[model samples]
Target: MSLGKKLKQLRKEYKYSQAVVARDIEVSQQAYSFYENDKKKPTMPVIARLARLYQIPMSELLNAEENTKEQQMEKFIEVLTRRIWAIIDLKYLNNNFFDLCLVIEEQARISLMSVQSREILEKKEFDLDYTTLGKLRGDYLEPFKEEIENKNQDTELIPNLVETIFLKEKEIASKYFE
Candidate 1:
């Protein structure tokens, strides 16, 4: 994913048209198109504006790389799942495991294609269906939950947790692309 593709993805995720993004970023529509098409790079100011618009750190926007779609999706899943875990932990700070699982189940209604589809329910190049979701939770999230429980909420353990999740997702996602 180049920065252009990242911009496009963010725009689509936010349901912003190119024109809307152009107006928000104070760039011409053609210039924004060029940026999304990889024909031109945006200046730091433009990048900063885009970062603000996307509500993400500028570092995330600027650090875009040319990775395969599989790698990108794997990374996306890992980041999202970790964020979900963190949210669950915060929301259930009373340490009610039952409530946590209930929240997780409710969140599971989320469809993955919101990030992948050009049109909702009309097209899907890839989707995280329930089967894969089950595998992911069983293979990665459960173990990570156990590990976190054992670690007693040590922040320093996050990197290792992320690495473990990433590796597990990579292994599971291999079947997905094939």
Candidate 2:
């Protein structure tokens, strides 16, 4: 297409008036309108200025493709990423324990879905010795520790509480090895 069509397309994409583009390019609105309507040709300098103002490569504007496969691929990726984040946001909104429990769980769940635990631990070289991982484990798996500690119970209940805590700790530990 002609320079006028390219300039008009760029102007419309940005919701810019012909007058604004003309003012910025140091041309009269009548001249810019003539250019857009293909009745007049813009000087080389005016074309350069228009290209700069539109923040698009002159080549892309002159040879604009409405839906190239590469552009379609990029748009698809952008939309898919937005949708994935929306789903994650919804999960956090629905779950009250979103703070630390959520993000870690989501990551772990994704990993498990894509690979076996052995592959994750061995092939991916996931670090099992991290201190923060330990803290996260304690936070998620041992939810009743504070309650057990703060309980106003008789001396008779101490052994039962201790046994429950021990069993839960053992269960959590076994998960790591598996």
Candidate 3:
């Protein structure tokens, strides 16, 4: 029972159309639709108005289970974003460009995989074991590392290497997003 579901249930019980409810709440019908779909959260004032309209407490309008799930998701995203930025923002690395780039690349791949939409993932037909980041890691990283090992780690090439990795990541991400 999400807030959306509760709102919808109340509307049905009262036999009111969305336009009627929107007029009562002083909002547009589109905004009311967004609330019922859980795409946007109503403000505290809007919630209080809804409570008064439905003759229910404001607390009853909020679904505790949905709030908990949303909180957990917010925390997870914060942790993931923090980890990636921490690696990318490293200022002092003991003159170790190779290790630093590798770390950043790995974290970038993890972020890419972890942040995919669950709805999109469910609709796609693909092997769960295969990921785009894993393929990119093999295609770009393995050969780069091997070349570095053979050529004795040229420091001047590190910048070009980092740029290539970033460009490849952007290209792959753009395709998916588009």
lDDT of 3 by residue, 1-178 (tens): 4677667756864679999999999999999999988899999999989999988778767653354434434433443456544653453133344665556556554544443433444555223423445655556655455544443444455455555655555554443232
Q: Tens digits of per-residue lDDT for model 1 on 1-178?
A: 5788778878866789999999999999999999998999999999999999988888877777744566556645744585557754573444444444444433432313323323432332234453445544554555545544543655454456545644554454444333
Of candidate 2, the 10-residue stretch with the lowest lDDT total is: 109-118
Alpha-carbon RMSD, candidate 2: 19.3
How far does residue 73 in candidate 1 sit from its true spot (Å)?
Answer: 5.5
Across 1-178, the per-residue lDDT of candidate 2 in tens digits comes to 3455556655754678989999999999999999888898777788778879966566554454343445433333333344334544443334333332444344443332222223434543345433245566456435544433343433234344334423333343333334
- Better structure of 1 and 2 per TM-score: 1
Backbone clash count, each prediction separately: 1, 0, 0
- Score every model by TM-score: 0.48, 0.37, 0.37
Query: Over the full model, what C-alpha lDDT does candidate 3 score relative to the true structure?
Result: 0.59
Supply the TM-score for candidate 2.
Answer: 0.37
Best lDDT among the predictions, by candidate number: 1
In what order do the candidates fall by lDDT, top score first? Answer: 1, 3, 2
